[model samples]
Target: MADKLKVALAIALVVAGVVGFYLLSEQALVLRVLSVLAGVAAAAAVASQSESGRRFVGFARESVTETKKVVWPSRKETVQTTGMVFAFVVVMAIFLWLTDKSLEWVMYDLILGWK
Candidate 1:
């Protein structure tokens, strides 16, 4: 029951923040933005008390930790792999073009005599 109420309040806070932004449009842009941010912080604080929100926060923290443990490829390895991929693509393009031209020649020049 308490968790449900906290979640609802969090949603309400976010909605109120959006409304406030529109309502305070006549105010200075910086002040209005700060107010909206404060509302978002409040909403986050309220939401963090809920079970689902806590789980999400834990998941985000774990994701960051796992990201840090990743072994990224070095710059040289990345560049070399990229160059090889480009070379293979060019070779395939040339091969496909030759095959297409050969088929066109056989169909039009030799078989149909349309040339």
Candidate 2:
């Protein structure tokens, strides 16, 4: 009975949230704040209860811990990479322009005799 009531209350909160959001969609600020409050209340109720909630909490904690272990590149490394990319693009652009000019010259002056 007690578990049923908790589940019902959580479901009610979420349903109320959805209805409220639909009604308040024209007022973005109020809708967002109310939606967040509703979500937090629902989460709190869920966390207060059975085995699934505990597992969810543990998973969330591990995710945060794993996120903290990431290593990021330095600014110097980023700048060097950016410079190399730009140099490659410039070289490719020049090569393409030269190839196009050579093709144009051969088609017009050599074959069609355009001078």
Candidate 3:
């Protein structure tokens, strides 16, 4: 029940921030943006107190840790893979164009005698 209330309060905070932005439309762009940011920051702080929020924070932290552990492809491997993909795309494009032109020739010139 308390967690639900906290979530609701967080949502309210976000909505209030949005309203504040609109209300401050005549103000400077930076100030309007700051209003929204402040609201969002307040909401985040409030939501972080909830159980589900805590779990989400933990999950986010774990995701960051896992990402750090990943062995990313080297620059050379990346370049080679990109080059192969580009080569394949160019070959496929030429093949498709040839097939299309052949079909058009057969349909118009040979079969229908329209060309």
Candidate number of the best TM-score = 3
TM-score of 2: 0.53
User: What is the TM-score of each predicted model, taking all chains together?
Assistant: 0.81, 0.53, 0.90
Compute the lDDT for candidate 2.
0.80
Clashing pairs in 2: none
lDDT of 3 by residue, 1-115 (tens): 9999999999999999999999999999999999999999999999999999999999999999999999999999999999999999999999999999999999999999997
Score candidate 3 by lDDT. 0.98
lDDT of 2 by residue, 1-115 (tens): 6666766666777777777777777888776678858866885676468565667778999999999998877999999999999999999999999999999999999999998
Estimate the TM-score for candidate 1.
0.81
Residue-level lDDT tens digits of model 1 in 12-93: 9988888888999999998888878988999999999999889989999999999999999999999999999999999999
**Model-by-model lDDT, in order?**
0.94, 0.80, 0.98
Candidate 1 clash pair list = none
Q: Runs in model 2 with CA error above 4 Å?
A: 1-18, 25-28, 31-33, 36-67
